[model samples]
Target: MSCYDTNIYKVARLKAGKTQEGAAEALGISVESLKAYESYSRLPPAGVVDRMCVIYDALYLAYQHNRIASGDVKVIPEIEVLDLPRASIRLINRVIQFAEKRRDRELLTIAEDGVISPEERPLYEEIVAELDGLIQAAMELKVAEAKEL
Candidate 1:
């Protein structure tokens, strides 16, 4: 089933306090079209689907902000740090190796001072750290795979 087949459209309409006519008017479509969309009797065009997603996302954001403002909800944004498990190591290293090779080309040049500017330094460091992690993970995976063989 498509993501649109989920309750996102219904929830958005309810939250917007819009009847079929109102929603259709807002969306520049017929009431029958809106009904068909909500009931999934007919799938919308790709542009229509994109528009619907944008509208629903906006409505949801408004609802969230309103709730937070009125103290009806305490919003806590989540920060997730994903560390890839061992199985992904070879793929990761291959990607990093490719990137490092690309960086060695003229496309990744710096200024003649041989010193990276402050703004560029952080990006460089982040890239280096990511490549290092990928290489390390790949090495570990190769050893494990070798033992299995």
Candidate 2:
């Protein structure tokens, strides 16, 4: 019953102007199955999620699904749904802030040699967090663009 599962699946469906029965038919699953997924009682398979992404014209749904399916591994960054203009602005801002902060120089310094020393750990963590922010911003922009298509 994670918020990611309930919120994104149901929200995306509704935002796409799809009723439960219609979305179920479009997804080629029973209404009960869709209900289970929407309620977070069961997670949908990746393949089903992929189809839903396309059918509902909501690509962010795929991103959310991948994030949820990753469990504790958490390779996917969390993202917010934004309008195209805001998404673009946020991504550009992230890139600008990263560059202005000399994150690349710091990261290069940290990675110049084979290993990260204990003293460099904090800086390395900061760089990694900034990179994650960049990734999340880019993903948000991508989702916004996808909605336009």
TM-score of each predicted structure versus truth: 0.33, 0.87
Residues 1-149 of candidate 2: C-alpha lDDT, one tens digit per residue? 44364567898898789999999999899999998898888999998999999988888788888887788976688888889999999999999999999999988888999789999999999889889999989998998898778
Candidate 2 — which residues are off by over 4 angstroms?
A: 1-5
The TM-score of candidate 2 is 0.87
Estimate, for each residue in 1-149, the C-alpha lDDT of model 1 and write its tens digit. 43234544565677667777877777788889878766757655655654554554332323222333344333322111123344465556667775776754422665456778886787677666655555545544443443344
* Clashes in predicted model 2: 0
Model 1 lDDT at residue 43? 57
User: Clash number for every model?
Assistant: 0, 0
Locate the minimum summed-lDDT window of 10 residues in model 1: 74-83
Indicate which candidate wins on TM-score: 2
Off by over 4 Å in 1: 1-6, 57-149
Residue-level lDDT for 81 in candidate 2: 80
